[model samples]
Target: MARVGRYDSRTIDKIYTHVTKKMDDNILDLLDNL
Candidate 1:
């Protein structure tokens, strides 16, 4: 159970990081367009 929980958390962290990185890129693109 502990191992599964740890793996799930790691996956969530990776997904979060990826989403945030994409958001940052979008924001940069918007700024460039302005």
Candidate 2:
């Protein structure tokens, strides 16, 4: 496998996806708690 380079779109996309999922999960939990 190739090593990831800086500013790679794929890496950025992966980070964005992980963060979005975390945010979505948190929001759902908050709504459930309310």
Candidate 3:
């Protein structure tokens, strides 16, 4: 049970990092356009 929880958390962290990075890129693009 503990191992499964750890694995799930790791997966979630990866997804969160990916989403945040994409958002940062989009924000930068908008700023550049302005």
- RMSD to native for every prediction? 3.9, 5.1, 3.9
What does candidate 2's lDDT look like per residue over 1-34, in tens digits? 1455666777788899999999999999999999
Model 1 alpha-carbon drift over 4 Å, by segment: 1-7
TM-score, structure 2 vs. true: 0.78
Comparing 1 with 2 on TM-score, the higher-scoring candidate is 2
Candidate lDDT scores, in order, read 0.87, 0.86, 0.86
Model 3 Cα shift for residue 22 (angstroms): 0.2
Candidate achieving the largest TM-score? 2
Q: What ranking emerges by TM-score with the best candidate at the front?
A: 2, 3, 1
The residue pairs in collision within model 2 are: none
Write candidate 3's Cα lDDT for 1-34 as tens digits. 3655656776888888999999999999999999
Model 1 per-residue lDDT tens digits across residues 1-34: 3655657776888888999999999999999999
TM-score of 3: 0.76
